[model samples]
Target: MAKLRLFVDRLSQPSRAIIIFCLANGLDAEENLVDLGKGEHRKPEYKAINPMGQVPAVDDDGFYLFESHAILRYLASAYPNVKEHWYPVDVKKRAQIECILDWHHTNLRRGSAGLVMNRVIAPALGHPLDPKAASECEALVKASLDTINTLWLNEDGSFLKGSSEPSIADLSLACEVTQLQFLGEETKAKILSPYPKVRNWLDAVEKATSPHFESAHEKLRTLAAIFEQRRESQSSEQPAAQSDL
Candidate 1:
């Protein structure tokens, strides 16, 4: 068997997501934590692996891959006997789950990225997000959640593929939504509250991806630590006026 290496950034939702999937499936991937804040990802060494220098990259033997969801699907497909719930066996059932994953990348991920960049990163760097941009981002996230709750996650069906257990789609969505906490307390509550079925699904995701998947508290703490360092660095880099003695 070839050695598996994961080039990840703990603070990245997608990166943490890959971590969960690998651990859930019982594979011990060698993790090389890439620190993005300090510009470590932009270096030539890491860039050779992923030209875009994005986190959540996987290197299996000499083959390199990016995009968190793609990596996850590849893992599940390669290890068919590991966990059936990771990826459904039936063709139609698998397609059904993929529909949700597509919806997540298009809607949920875009909206949540806006919230995270504007609310978390901008502030730490001493710039505030424009009111209109923030408002639009918030509305989009809420609307995406609403659609997930009412359309796909109807009360009649239990999971995305109508399975009692979670699928890869749930894992992908959970990874992105979990990062919303970095936006703020009020934002976190609002995004999580309105949808009953979504909340239930979230609980199922956490339960299904057990011990290896971080507890909610652990995720938040990790983000807080990252942002705190960001704030400290921003504060230090600010220019101070000098007075001649």
Candidate 2:
């Protein structure tokens, strides 16, 4: 039997989510890194796997899949070993999880991804930082966090939608929050400070997911360290440049 082939770039939140899911479920999956920075995802060979040319596509034997959410649902349904809490068999429970998943794309993901792109990625790609755009994104992000704190986060449980265990929705959103590691520590704290419940829920998800969660984020952690170092170097150089003026 061919192992599930997972093509991913760990720096991507969704990719990390998929990796963590597979590892946590103990699926026999082969991880194939697709370097988005080098445009490997756009190559014809990779396109043959996913026409959209995106990282985090999967080939489970001959069946191919793209989009992290779809892939997660498929894997949970396909593999009998996957625990029910991750995506329950019960209709009501599943539907509740589905609702959160749907809301995530337009709300949490939009704000978080937009902020990361504007504040971190755009500048790395040689584009000037857009403070106005980033500020807009930050507002949306805070709104989304408030919603999660007040709505989705259950008082009865540690997970989303009142579930006692972590689900696919939990993993997805938790991974999205982890992307804020790219931001300056102070900036990240300011964004999260108002929502202590959201922060606690994130910690619960991490604890539930355990070693796999941390392992999957190893690349992100490494890159974040480098990003911080680079930011400090640039800041130090700025004063010297101004002094010479």
Candidate 3:
């Protein structure tokens, strides 16, 4: 197997998941910064890799892939040495896991992404996201959290698909949860306090994959600087205090 290449912005939850998954699984991959903070990802060079300008893009030999869920699957499937059995070979188990992961991207991650983008990145850059949009973001975030609460209310400790070991679902969800932590301590505490099992599961994930959140703080610094620049630029074009979406 050729050394893999991962183009990513560490601050993005999906990107972080892929980065951590690869490291945890002992897959050799090169990391390149596609700094979203600086809008560098929009550059043509990077766009050729991921036209949408998203991170967590991977290159194996000559093959390339985008959309982080696929990347995770590739890492787990193409290289079985990772010892990530939670992915499941059994059709039924794999189907269940895939369902959770798919739901996460559209429902769970979507809501959290709005909160992170609106509260942290938007104002910090220059855009100053609409106050209404910001409020809506909070509502959606609460909804997402409630769903998490329901998911783990079961007597079983399984975070997803009755598996104790971490899987793609855990990887993807943890990345989003980390964003809430970065958004504000208050929001994180509230959401996590209600879901003790989820919290424990996330901790287990970090422990299982040594250095699970490696370079997380470092990632914040890089993202912050970019947000500031965007905020300044956007604030110039329109009032930063724009109300509602």
Pick the lDDT winner.
2
Global lDDT of each model? 0.77, 0.88, 0.73
Deviating ranges (above 4 Å) for candidate 2: 239-245
lDDT string for model 2 (1-245, tens) is: 44799999999999999999998898999999999778899999999999999878999988999999999999999999999999998999899889989999998899998888887778676688676887798888999999999999846899898788999999999999989888866678778999998999988988988988888888888887787777777769785541211
Clashes of 1: 0
lDDT of 3 by residue, 95-163 (tens): 877887888876678777877777666755677756566568667777666666666424365555456
Residue pair clashes in candidate 1: none
Candidates arranged by TM-score, highest first: 2, 1, 3
In terms of lDDT, the poorest run of 10 residues in model 1 is 236-245
Name the lDDT value of residue 83 in candidate 1: 85
Full-model lDDT, candidate 1:
0.77
Candidate rank order under lDDT: 2, 1, 3
Q: After superposition, how far is residue 161 of candidate 1 from its true place, in Å?
A: 3.6
Q: In angstroms, how far off is 190's CA in candidate 3?
A: 2.6
Which ten-residue region of model 3 has the weakest summed lDDT? 152-161
Instruction: Report the lDDT tens digits of candidate 1 across residue range 82-194.
Output: 58877888988888888888888778888888877765667555678565676688788899988888887864546664578777888778778877867555557667898
lDDT over C-alpha atoms for residue 217 of model 2 = 82
Per-residue lDDT value at 98 in model 3: 87
